[model samples]
Target: MTAVTDEGPGQVRGQVAGQGPGPERGRNPDEGSAPREGLPKDRGRPGRDWDDGLIARRAVSGAAPQEAPAAVPDDDVRPQVEAYVPSGSPLSPRLDALRELVGLSRARLDRTDLAEAGRVLDEAAARQRLSSRHTVVAIAGASGSGKSTLFNTLAGAQISEAGLRRPTTAAPIACSWTDGAAGLLDRLAIPGRLRRRPQQSGTGGDEALQGLVLVDLPDHDSAAAGHREQVDRVLALVDAVVWVVDPEKYADAALHERYLRPLAGHAEVTFVVLNQIDRLPGEAADQVLDDLRRLLDEDGMALGEHGEPGATVLSLSALTGDGVGELRELLGRFVQERTAATRRLSADVDAAAARLRPVYVAEGWPGLGERAREEFADRLAEAVGAAAAGQAAERAWRRNAGRACGTPWLRLWRWYESTRQPRGLDRTVFAAPPEEQLTARQRVEQAVRTVADDAADGLPGPWAQAVREAAVRGAQGLPEALDKLAARAGAEPGRDTDTDSDNGEPAEAAETAEPGGRTGAHRGRAAGRPPRPAWWPAAVLAQVAMTLLQIFGGLWLIGQIIGVLEPGLLTPALVMLAGIIGGPLVEWSCAAAARGPARRYGQEAERRLREAAAGCGRARVLDPVAAELVRYREVRERYVAVTEFSTTRG
Candidate 1:
């Protein structure tokens, strides 16, 4: 039974035997549907067999009609559409990989340039969500090709009156074997009154097609541009297609050049039907079928001609029902396997991946983080004048040692020079010139730029630009940070006591408050002002003894000159000579011993400065560059997964 309800002018809704009420009339189907920019607004449905205009009715089981159409977001609502595929299925990995590709591309690449990929994803997502239980197949052909006759023959009922009376199929019509396909038809923007179901008695042997939805598309070579537009749109969405051709138009240039050649990748879900074959006389039918097979092969469609797994071509006569049963049997088996949807989606993914292949790396990925880090640290170390600081420390140690152990006359001369210079010897006696400081700052900037360049090397344009931008963002305020470190570079490290352990090892120096460098060496400080050696006291005592000997000899000579005692020139002179020579010998020994400690002190100063600079570099540039590379790596991984899925399937 069927119920008709007329809600408004030119608006109609139908209620079938078991299917529920349709949506309210006068509402646009596209208000909640996916993008269909090129489709026409509905005046009336096409391809309906009924004398009455645009009405479809079907009887279904109580449990057949789904409560909701595949409820998925439209393209306007969600920028990247994700389709539902059951986990562990063959199509699941590829679907997930394609979704990830779209997302990553939006984030890394220009959004404006992804129109084609986004369209593919949007259409595929909508189709998958519309009905997992249903498979949509379209029958398409040129004008007067008897495509509608084949469509009606496969449907077991008349679908459209366009086969021989007219030169073009005005629009598309849909015939479904089961219910719950209203959402899918809505996706194609089919009117509610235009969908139909085959008679219940006629569906007896078609149990394999329980969820099949067949669409009769308009003439592919129709003179009316609208008919051809409708054909292309329907063909793009259906899971599989059966192209109907007659003997006259079997090898027509319009069909092969327009539709067959471009969709060669979709051979797995394709069928080529040679309709109206009974019109061929004698063996002409076989000859035309063989020739059609040759043309399909030339069009790059994988075929079952050599028993390979590919498109199935067959001869049929819809008027006489000669080969219609064979097509039905083959189509039933195809629907039963349920690989059509997956195969179609896989082919779409293949096409999208091919277009995007040029933007990614063709070979192995190499990282430059470790090498860049070391080079960056070295550069910073050089920028902060670490080597120069070390040299100053060495010179200071030598100068202090000379002061402590030099002859009295030389010490007096050094004191006079210090007084004239008016500068203390305990600290950094030399200041960096303005020009040197400017050069150091420039080197710091150069180090950052160098790391940024290295990070971006060999990357694709967008990723390389992203890495350089990240480096710049992280390297802000680096010069000021170095200046703070350099200010503390000359500070002296404190020592607890001027004593050695029981094993004769010097006590460790206290930790410096400076950040660029860690604690100095145990025996000496970064400032090179080490604790007095154990032998220093002995040298000082020996110098005191020598001075006393000289003093005693001088006093004796004075006493003799004053006539208070007898003069002994040889003994006194000998004692004075020994004192003079012994003092010089002590000074020479001390200078030689301090050389080793001075070198060690210089090394500590340089090491501390280098560490400070390295820490600054890491904070400002290296870590951020690494983070950018990590993000790029993730994007690359998604690309790899997408390519692998397509490659393995192909």
Candidate 2:
């Protein structure tokens, strides 16, 4: 039931209800109330010996009782209530920001219990709908704070009983100025018996208080546990709170530490009313009010629209009715401005943002870099046997080319060599492609996992999970795709043979050159085929010239022997020897020249095969992995955006 009247800088008027120093705490406020059966011995303050009948009359007229102590002049106090206009207006923009944040983080929030957030959001919408019609303010305090008295003073009627009872108001009592707030009161769960309208509603003086719904909540520090629970529940849903404190317990740890400190952001809608201030000596009241302001500052509660030190603090004697006019006037302005609900919601958004900061704090989610991606692809290439395939292509090509352009005699032997199966390669393993298949598939899967792990490293849980999912999406079907690609690459190495088959002349010549004899010596003779070297025609023409020389020389020798021509034995014999030596020499030189072409042909075949194999590696393994890297990058960017958006400004 605390209420404040802000006059100017360094000055505030408020009301409270006790007469001694602030109380010493026996337990932590955070522990909540003890069990109902374990109530403290001094359940509430000792009863006042003062006349209750005199207090009630003074409260109705908003004046202090004659016997109460005199209060200090307002200017003599150094400053308790700073003039506070709530900082932000029209909470729609902040609400929209918060709603957008919720939408963006919906997936993450779904994992957590949503009750509190749901309640706050629901309350915000409800408050917005009723914004023009009502501002619900709660009057809450500890035992012996005279909160009920203050509630009656503000309403100008004794709606709530003000007495020495430990927990006088077990349930909330709602006093509405206007008639249209029944629904709002229903939302607050105020019983029909506890709801009341201003006593003299037709008086134009009540116009200032229109749209105001003041609720007197049960004592927060009540002996009964349920009373405190009711206070807490209402505090959470109320648009504004007036915390009532007597001069004695204004600095109660349970009040500041548990409630005020946690709600530091709600300072704009918070009013600190020092009740029973008339019980204190004039100077003592100022000292107590200043102390309460200091404690609130320590609670991190910013007071004014300019972000000052504390909420509006004012002193008043509810029993004496002192400061009641200022309190009513302040509340009138509070209702007329119609921003308490918006301010409360804005504060709510700030609190929620602070609580949720950890989840969206951006760090270590840079994702896979280009160099890492290339390295990953390289690793997969080796695992999938890309390099081995390339080398195999090169070897197969050399074998095919060797048979294609070798010397005629050697080509015949090489063709026969081609028919022989290669040794050492496990044909059994080849027969079961599954074994080879597993190797490539496993390699790819491991690579995918590794890259994903690296990308997710040092990231927050949700972003890291997103990175992992992206990697998985990119990796889907990759193993089978790579297997097909490798097979194609392997098949490419054998394509040269098909191309050779398309040239019918080579096959026919090859079959003709095959050894056709049974005996080993006759096999060599059958294997001898004329070399297809470029110099073969020159060699053959030279042999033809030599044969003609030999034949003519032989004819001349025969003529000499038969005395049918002039005889010259030296010339004819020399001619016969020269022709025989030169013909074989020419043929031998042509065979030597053909060897280089055969080697060069084999090298060309190897180069083509190697290119094909490397191409397969790029297409099958590197490309898919690169695609994954791209996805990782995209997710990383999104994570960064989320973090920045969530943290930088709330």
Candidate 3:
């Protein structure tokens, strides 16, 4: 019996009838005394058993080792092999996450990075569609690390230059295993001159690596700036990276600090190779590999998930081909999994999100308080001259009330005094003082600015600026609006009658007799009633009777003096005194009674005017300011939503 050998990675040797193990290689546990139907009398010393060496080789190569077949004879055994199974694409979900971020933040944030991320997604998607089966693995290393030699050895030909040129592999070289990778190569910007084809003999086990495209990149630490740039550019776009480091420079700080440290999260598709181990003894190679792993751990990289050191730490000599088969096997498995692209994209997203975490952090979202709102409103009222207007209305009402109900004898003097208009009005209603003349307009404008500034306090720069702008916009036409609103409010209440019309006629008194206004109008109108009291006629009749009595007394006294009647001087004089005193007392009493009505009318007028002015202030100033506050709140909510994702992700 002969042991089957694999020439290239994952290639299986041909099986002979009844002379070897099953089609799949590996020693069967029950093979010691099994009889076969074939006529070979004696199986030559049992074919080399698939032992620890083979299993260890596959394990170190990042491949899942298959179970050994049963030792049952060929008549009863039939091997089943699955050729290819594709891992579902992970790029779709990652792209969706990226797009979600862009959708929410583009309007509010600096989108330069987001735009670049979008480009990456688009390019990645297009590349995957054109060549889903292809796995782009780039060979990256610092200068003099045997990266090109490994690339050549992997290609099974002299594809990349491997000699003593300082900063070799100036341009990237792509080695494709199968046809149809031309479009993908173009997308990667690999020139036709740098492209090569690896030799392919048969399908079988080699079919697993059919779509693998290996790239030889320029030195990462190359003195030539362009060479380093080339390495960086290819590293960002490739599906996987195999970092080739020799035993001598395995722990170089330039490689770990600049590249590995930053790419810690990308360990899934990262490979750290300890190349040129032929220079070191077996034990020394092991020690070097250990030290290299320690350095990788310090850089915060987790290996093994995607064929990197965490899974299998490789120490091979690209010059002598020693231990090269293990690496090929790992590459074969990596290509078969077909997950490198998705893994690469996912890591990129993670890195992008990490960079964006700071901008999305939270302080707190407590909104404007009720106290602030009321304070602002009060300021606005003062600015609109609401208080002054109210006071003027009160004074004007009192003047009108005094003229209407004051003593009839003094009416002329009172009317003359009242005809002079109050300080700021021609009518009994309230209006805003002229905007330009009134200090209130400027005060109101300042109050608007103050309120806006207050609302924006403690907010982020962009959001705070937004709130301020909204407030400024709301206040743009406010001064003029206040004036118009005040005029309208003042006119709306007393439209029915021109009670305060400028005139000195008795008709003015008649007009004042109509119902007064405001909260106190009921009492005012009742008090201002000018109709004669029920007993007023009686008082007048009594006064007339007293006068007649005085006249009779006087006549009697005169007759007596002339010697026509008996003496009555005392009675005649007393009657005259009573008539005079009673008339004056009644007049004084009526005047006293009218005072209450006049005062009530004044109060009612003042109340109405104040209400009108306040209404105007609310409409023209407070309401618009409130609308701006509402807008700020809405934007705040949107901002919070946009930043919330970052918070949760971080």
- Which of the two candidates, 2 or 3, achieves a greater TM-score against the reference? 2
**For each candidate, C-alpha RMSD in Å?**
13.8, 13.8, 18.2
Top-scoring candidate (lDDT) = 1
Best by TM-score: 1
lDDT for 385 (candidate 3): 48
Task: Return the number of clashes found in candidate 2.
Answer: 25
Q: TM-scores of all models?
A: 0.69, 0.62, 0.59
TM-score leaderboard ranking: 1, 2, 3
Off by more than 4 A, model 1: 1-84, 93-107, 113-129, 141-146, 156-158, 161-167, 196-208, 219-229, 243-265, 272-326, 349-363, 422-438, 489-535, 539-565, 638-650
Q: lDDT per residue, candidate 1, 381-469, as tens digits?
A: 87766776676567556656666676776666655554564233322223334565567667877888898888787887777887888
Q: Candidate 2: lDDT of 128?
A: 54
Write one digit per residue (lDDT tens) for candidate 3, span 1-650. 00012121111122233433212122211221221122111111134222222111111223332223222211111222221113343345445556666665566556653544465556555655666667889898866677888887787667687655665578999887765667667766888778876644223236657879889988766656566556666666677889887644455545554567767767777888888776664376676677677778777887574533343457898877888889999889888877667666666656555555443433565345667666676666555444444433443444554444333434655556666746433323332235433465567677777776777666555555656676677677765665555555544434422233434322232222211111122112212222233555555565456556656766767887998987777876676667556545555554565456534544444444445444544555456555555654554454344333331111
Off by over 4 Å in 3: 1-114, 199-208, 247-258, 277-329, 354-362, 366-379, 386-413, 418-442, 450-460, 496-650
Q: What is the C-alpha lDDT of each candidate?
A: 0.63, 0.56, 0.56
